[model samples]
Target: MTRLDAYLNRIGIARPSELDAAGLLAVQAAHRQAIPFENIDVRLRQAIPTESQAVFDKLVTQRRGGFCFEHNRLLSDMLAAMGMANRVLLARVTFGDPPALPPLTHCLLLVTLPDGQRMIADGGFGGTYCPPLPLADGAEATSGDGARHRLTQIGAPGTLPGEWLLERMGPPETSDGRGRDHAAWEQQYAFELADTAPADLVMGSHFASTHPSARHVNCHVASRVLPDGFVSLLERQFSRYRAGHPVERREVADVAEYRDLLAREIGVDLPVETLDRLPLWAGAD
Candidate 1:
């Protein structure tokens, strides 16, 4: 088993164990606070590894945040080290301005406790960690913050019995047919228990990073959740979403300052070669 103290300390998870709801919340909070949700490595020529040691080296040893595969894989390993039984699953992410590429897939973790209880633990999701949703559908789960999120079964068996959906109830906002208002929330990601192997994500990750059509190739976006709301860093703007409030967007002027924030605030510092790619977005100004 991996050392729990080292793993928790690496991610700033101060809690003793993430076995219950409170502990789970602490783990999520620490994950968002410590590790960044970034695609910079993909932008760089750095190849994210699929093996456990390589993942640990890249994420824990190197102190970097990765996409779904890197984050969930490491998290799963950490849980295992903590003597927790867990499984890995894959999901096709449909985010804001969804990726146009074919294998724009995602990875998440499913953990089962000794009591036959199952919960979803995902520190990989950029800005949403409402709570640990039960593996069973039609189950309503609420985070410690009082945000109500639920999982509902989506597809039928003999096809994808593990298929499920998620939704959260938030504040109201002006609608634009993007599903509904801010209060209505939206479909986060659709996932199932199809038993996706780590090898599958490796191939997908390679394609995503190398393909010119991938979203990571076009722009830069880094997001991490906070106790209240969240903070996101886009091309030249930093947006903060506070609890019970709309998102606050700020334009960053200094090119040097933007790079500094990417390193300091985002926690995933890019190398010199990767830093040179910023000019591609100069026309946006």
Candidate 2:
């Protein structure tokens, strides 16, 4: 089968007759459900190959999960195969109130639909819009997994820059250590509709995957969007959410537990030998 057919099968979706909003949403949700965001290879100290075919082989043929670079590379490539007009954009992931400024290391898509409307296809990120997010500023959309999201422009009035900030409706921080009652818009990431090149993604992935202190390299990270919620594994801690609210949490004890969770919850099945590369997916002791 052609890679496109394989990809559609992998995502458990038939090719959309017309690539419109509904079709895009279906693909986005299915993609997230099937291919989780993960960094096992990076955690294993393997060099992340950023080539399109390499990513396709690992994600589609091998039936594995990967991080932003691998995820969006496959999406952008599939959109091209579908004859959709889309381009890749790099963004700085700011999970709201980041202790330090981050660099642009996230990948997303700017797709011009047939009707001339634009949407952001972020197939990788967790707690993100399930459909391609609408491009209009201040317009809100509900995600497939029950989360809410919207875009806001940057800069002064009438002098809006190309950069767009993405935010999700989440709980407000509380000083009492107990959760607050009100919901607030939290910054997720920001990106510009500027031209991005393939090399840009490769460069970013190289740094993130190779840098000794990078988060992915230091811990176990994986996430899969559920039909009604989400499940994430990070820093040896596993969390499950329902309706965008946390419902469960636990720490993975050993490699066996990690392997089971990776398979049962996150939809990834690594070989025993591969799982041995990281004893506990831990950081500094």
Candidate 3:
């Protein structure tokens, strides 16, 4: 089957009848729902290959989910196959709220609509902002999952020129219950408008997958955006959020439950035995 056909079928969405905002939203949302944002292979200490054929084989033919590099690269290719104009841009992730800037390790797809509007698909951030938001300065959008996000152009981080900052509305206060007014808009990432070079993506993907301190190497993480909320697994903790509110949080009992939870809530299936490679599971009770 053609690449476009296979992609649409994998995501369980028919070809778009038109090339518009709604169409872009549907395509992106469906992709997020079907293909989870995950770091399973990294956790398993496997090599990460960003090449087209390798990514297509692992994420598509093998029916597995991957992180930003793999996810966005495949999405970019799929969009191109569907006659959509798009480019990949690397970004510095800010999910941890670090004191200083992080490396440019995330991949985001920027697409030009028929009307000249540029919509950005979140590199591999599932369960958070799934819809494509306009790349324009001060562009604010609420995703289908009801998560609020705003993108604004600003001076690039750490002595660079200009770049855009994407922020998501996070919880109201700090985890310690320190009083903070409204649920603040947390910085998600920052990226320049320029198209990322192929070599840069290769290096970035390597850093994210093989770096000793990278989150993927240290712990397990997977997320899937739901129709009305989000479901995610971080290390051993499993969480479900609804309408921006935390509804459930608990530790996964063991590897068996982890595998079942991924299939039950996220719609992504994997070999149960391979999951034992994770550090948490590698050790005996």
Candidate 4:
């Protein structure tokens, strides 16, 4: 079978007849739900090549997951193969405590649908929108799985002209009485619609996958979007979430159990030898 066919099978979706917004949403949701966001290769001491074919091989053929660059690059290539127009974009991650500034390290897509409407299609971010978010600033978009997100232009003092911020909107209970609740909506990342070349992503992926200070290099991070909520594995801690329900978390116990959880829960299959080599909390305390 062709790589496209393999990818479609991996995501458990058949090719759609038309590449419209609905079709785009279906594909994006499938990709997010099927291929998890992970950094197992980094922990295994394997080099992650930023090329499209390498990414496809690992994600589709080997049944492995990857970080932003790998996941989004593969999705972008697939969209291109299906005759859709998409531009790769980079963003600086700011979701962490104290926030990461500068050196745009996250990769995503700006796709023009069949009807000429532009949207942001991202399969990499764990807790963001599933269906593509409309590119219009201040316009809200809801994912198929019920997550709400929006985009807004950031102004002044370190923000560039046209720099857009993608924020995740909290549910009603999390909102304060005032309309302007900083705690109500959280900023996922800051990015501009400026063109991002392949080389830019290669450099960004290099730092994200290998740098000692990079967060991915330190922990066993993996996440998958579920029908109701989400499943995530951080270091040895595994957590499951459902909308309107509390987060359920547990310790992974040992390497064998960790490997089993990856294969069974997250849908990633890694060799036993490789799993044995991975350091527990490689860069974390």
Clashes of each: 2, 0, 0, 0
Measured against the true structure, the TM-scores of the candidates, in listed sequence, are 0.83, 0.88, 0.90, 0.88
lDDT of 1 at 195: 72
Q: Of 1 and 2, which scores higher on TM-score?
A: 2
Residues 67-130, candidate 4: write the lDDT tens digits: 8899998999899888789989888766543233646778889999878989888988754444
The C-alpha stretches of model 2 lying farther than 4 A from their native spots are 127-130, 156-162, 171-182, 244-246, 279-285
Ranking of models by lDDT: 4, 3, 2, 1
Instruction: Please report how far candidate 2 places residue 275 from its true position, in Å.
Output: 1.9
Can you rank all candidates by TM-score, best first? Answer: 3, 4, 2, 1
State which candidate has the highest TM-score: 3
RMSD of 1: 3.9
Model 3 lDDT on a 0 to 1 scale: 0.75
Candidate 4: stretches off by over 4 Å = 97-100, 127-130, 155-162, 171-183, 244-246, 281-285
lDDT score at residue 174, model 4, on the 0-100 scale: 20
Deviation in angstroms for 43 in model 1? 1.8
Worst 10 residues of 2 by lDDT: 172-181
Candidate 4: worst-modelled 10 consecutive residues by lDDT: 172-181
Worst 10-residue stretch by lDDT in candidate 1?
A: 171-180
Model 3 TM-score, 2 decimals: 0.90
